[model samples]
Target: MFPLFLWTALLGSAALEGPESRLLCTSPDLSISYSFCGGISHMLSLGVKSCLTKDNTKDDLYLFFVPKRDIIELSVAIQVWFKAVQVAKFTEPLCRGFDDEYSFCGVLKGETINITVPFSYRKFIFPQGQYTVLFEGISGRSNDLIFCVNATVILK
Candidate 1:
């Protein structure tokens, strides 16, 4: 009977809280489609998938430029057991045509857990007039993760 009570209490507490999530959208000088996923328990990382389309017969040169400075918005959902979740925000410059974007570190019950990670670049340079950009997120805890995702880039 004691074990049943503990299980019920745990399950009840878990049901009280839901997962965390965030939404992001923007327009850029290139066209792209991609997906992002992330997790955090003790570390941080990101993954991206991208594709580009160009008119081969055109003489126009494509230039993709990454932002040197910018701001981002991070959203996260929390569950009951991990109620004390906190998220941190920061920025880093990209290499040439790509910038290193990150999500603010999230903390729950004094433990730094991974949260949503979303990034943006002001101007990116692509070698061709048409290209695709994919931004991705990775995490130390795969099963418990948040994905702050956007999936479209405008053409210049």
Candidate 2:
């Protein structure tokens, strides 16, 4: 059950510089402006999704997601870089993480959900390349867009 707030670090700006400090998806100063993110498509506000910050930083994460419609159910997908292209990796429920303050089972429209909580990430190594993740939600009733966003990250 992947939460919505966990994978949003890729939504951070793309101007990140330097080697160790350049790409900071988990930085509290992270911004949602897609213009900053090279691979992000579509516009989003803030509500759900989880992110795994750099394993060394045991900092509190400020959760944010933007949803622009009344949600009936969630339809989510994940993609990663492959052969110099982005490919679908996973498709699953991303709203299960919003148990306390927000939930997909409920209805929301043109609003944002914000929360701050301390988080820890398991130590793991990523391949040297670019990885992309995408997610979205659609209303089953009216077939309108609820939320949609994607991000790409490069590791050297």
Candidate 2 lDDT score at position 44: 30
- Candidate 1's TM-score reads 0.24
Error of 2 at 120 (Å): 5.5
Q: lDDT tens string, model 1, 30-149?
A: 444333333221232233322223322112222121211122322233211111221222332222122424323232323333343233342433332332222223233332223323
lDDT of the candidates, in the order given: 0.30, 0.44
Strongest candidate by lDDT: 2
Ten consecutive residues with minimal summed lDDT in candidate 2?
31-40
Candidate 2 deviant stretches above 4 angstroms:
1-66, 85-88, 94-105, 116-124, 140-143
